[model samples]
Target: MGYQELLQNKQYLFWTLQFVGWSGWAMSFYLGIVMWGRPPDNYGFYLPTIAMIGMTITLGLRWMYHLTWDNGLLTRVVAILGGSYGAAVLWMFSRGVIFYNAFPEERKVYEGGSMSFFSYFDGSVSAFWVMLSWSALYFGIKYYLLMQEERQRSLKAMNMAHEAQLKMLRYQLNPHFLFNTLNAISTLVLDGNNSLANVMVTRLSRFLRYSLDNDPMLRVTVAEEIEALQLYLDIEKVRFDERLRLHFDVDSAASEALMPSLLLQPLVENSIKYAIANAIDGGSIAISASVTGRDLELVVADDGPGLDLRNGRLPKGGGVGLANTRERLKALYGNKQSFRLSTTEPHGLTITIRIPLENTTDSE
Candidate 1:
């Protein structure tokens, strides 16, 4: 069994500890009686006998320890120590009885309450120390294991929360996108452009189908994300015609980088809403991506009026799009990714995003 699995098996741990402890006790007894020529007893008989008795007594103590294992801290301290000392006293008395019976002649030679009593008391103290040590180790390991399990549970909860947040962010884009497209279709129908309206409706259906096909948590390649954004732009293009000039400047190396599904749509939609929709002569929306080191840098820039920095209020660009994008990036990459907005040198606003370059499908 693995170390963690073995540590969790109380039965196995108890028996293993009992065997090692009693073996050590037997070795000490042999050293004193045989090697040092002290006590001068029959080592062969006494060693195995004492070891077996020690193992049996500790086994009973092990059962008692388990009974009080799950109690409150104070109660456990009292119960375990009390049980250990009681078991020690009982074991010492039993050993004395056995030794007396085994060596009747030696017992008869001993005077009343002298060497015999001291020896028995010494054994009781030894047993008490051993049991005390065992209790400390048992509780220590149990608490460590409990803490590990608790940590695992906490991480699981955090991941669930992250996923819920991601879903919420993904959902936020849908309603805003739908409202704009429906309004566009309404405008086209009112202007007697039925063919364009019909085409826009078809593109909208395809875009929605693509969004529905991919899960919110699915990690998509940069190429796939771009395709989905293109579907969205197609619907908008029909309404604006030559006025909406869309450009893609994605590098071939960065095209395979993995990202959250439909991550860039909101940025593009924001550009259309704040830039293209406001301009009578239309504007240019550019989406570009490049790889540097282990990072993928993406920028969505549009030529528009840009943000008004004079007044306290910012531009209409920083709406649900910026907020949702920022939240999603935080949820997915934590502190590893960056998203920022800045006005272009001459005109328009630019949204820059930097994320880790996870190129392989399995890397995600």
Candidate 2:
């Protein structure tokens, strides 16, 4: 999505492959010349061939690293170091042919260094040094690559966990609402309220369609949310008759606001189940929505018995009340939104949910 992300992604792979190929080429070419005792003509021809051989092996190591290994710094280091060590050993043995046919002049090649380096650095000795040097470099590159991959994997896993927690929170609210709405429909049917029951059944079908069709990357408009809420409330209407009244005072601009899917239906279901369904004379639910700056604030309030107030007491609708709502808000908005609850007026509980809409793209 950003420059840094691209660098850490496909570009990183490209650069790593280039680094490995060129490094091994340089290593093999120089080693080939040293092994040949600086042969005048064949030296150039054999060095390029050796470079190609070295690169072929390095590319294989890279492929294995990308596809099979854990893609962690440690695994990359082990694979490259181990693989290149084997390659170097093979190269050394091939060049060790020069060691058996030794002469005074051949050893002189390693003697020119300022440290008064001996012929011990020539022929087989020189081959060993080149092989081991490339091996060490292989290990270092692999280690760094694996570390980068491990970090990226950790971040992806964390995001997955966060998204799962959000889905669970949203799901938890569903069964409670299901049980309550079904109970209301049952009561209406038993009392022979056919017209109301049919209406509620239609609303229930539409409500379910929205609930079950949620996608992870899309936000639902505010209008869609309120429509689903009204559908759920329609079922409550049949059960409560005149006693359950709902008032929606939503700003015209707020109706187009974007939010995580399935947000409003849960809050509205909680209001009906805990407030209107549990109230002695039933109750009224008032929904007020407004767009404040780039954020949307929605308040679902009701006049009913105050919070259970008793410590450790679960609310009437199987504790799916504010807890699930809070979790869903957290999952969808992370720490960027708020779901505030308080009691107001003579017989009411009010919940104020605020969510930013400027970057509503990530909500689902």
Candidate 3:
């Protein structure tokens, strides 16, 4: 692998640090001896030999420490200290043998004085310090990298959750409307009204085409949304006949304002359910839109029984459409958008939505 790849790999990094640390330490030791007028007889070979020995022992301690590093702070500390001391003793014995063979005359102190373990350990004090430092740095870096990885994973999971919610809201429209329209067409065919049944089928196909063409996460112009809603109302008109009427008063200037695709379908469908279908004489549903300063406001109101407003707001058991629309609006716009439901003047329900006027594109 390349040098950059080697530096990134944990196993390679450990060996690199061992080689760099010991080689630098040996170079400094040799320079110190030279400056003090006590230069080694053959430091070119001797210093390199010492560095290789230190690197080998350092690598062994690294593996030993890895086996018990996560046992706990107390356990790791004890293992590091004890393991470092043991490796230092072994290194000292190897160095002693090399030194005596290279210069037998320099072994006067060992021959003349009493041999003891303390003397060997005293000579290897520097090795213990090197091993301890290596252990501290290893654990510190590993923990920091682990924390970074966890934070990235959390952000990825949150993004996935947001996308899933949008998809659920988009697909919710398909089955509910499909079932109702198919049932209406079935009734028309059974009554020998084949021409009207064919008209309903055609309108239903056009409505589903518009709804399914775009991605759930995409935003479309207000004019585009209105067109899709018109197609839906046409299909319902077949079922309700002269009993259902729709009025559109969209401001030309605000028609191009962007909104989530199919955002208004459920609200209009809710009006049909609780207003037109529930009334004996049927009812009229009106959609109006206008832009005022920094905000775009749209309203869907119908003349029917209106809400009960028992405790406050509409009665419970409201269909999934209204609830799903509310959740999607909250997820997309947070607190920047508003959805308000209230009873109309005489007897009816009105849903008002206000969103920021962020789209600058004119209707095409």
Top of the candidates by lDDT: 1
What is the RMSD, in Å, between candidate 1 and the native fold over all Cα?
4.5
Clashes of 1: 0
Instruction: Give the alpha carbon lDDT tens digit for every residue of 89-131 in model 1.
Output: 8777877877777776677666453566447667788878866
- Compared to the true structure, candidate 2 yields what TM-score? 0.66
Candidate ordering by lDDT (highest first): 1, 3, 2
lDDT string for model 2 (126-179, tens) is 444554565555556567767878988998998889777777777767777777
What are the TM-scores, per candidate, against the unseen true structure?
0.78, 0.66, 0.64
> Which of 2 and 3 is ahead in TM-score?
2
lDDT of 3 by residue, 1-364 (tens): 8965764586776667667777788888888988899765765777788678867886787778778866987888888788888777777777766776665555565666785334655777876676667666666767765676687689889878988889898787789888989999999999999999999999999888877787777788789889988899999999998889889999987898888888888888888988999788999999988898888898889988887765434456776887788788888899998878888778888888888885845433
List all candidate RMSDs to the true structure: 4.5, 7.2, 6.7
The segments of candidate 3 whose C-alpha lies over 4 angstroms from its true place after superposition are: 1-137, 251-254, 291-296, 310-312, 356-364
Worst 10 residues of 3 by lDDT: 308-317
Q: Model 3: how far is 43 from its true place, Å?
A: 15
Local distance difference test values of all predictions, in order: 0.82, 0.68, 0.80
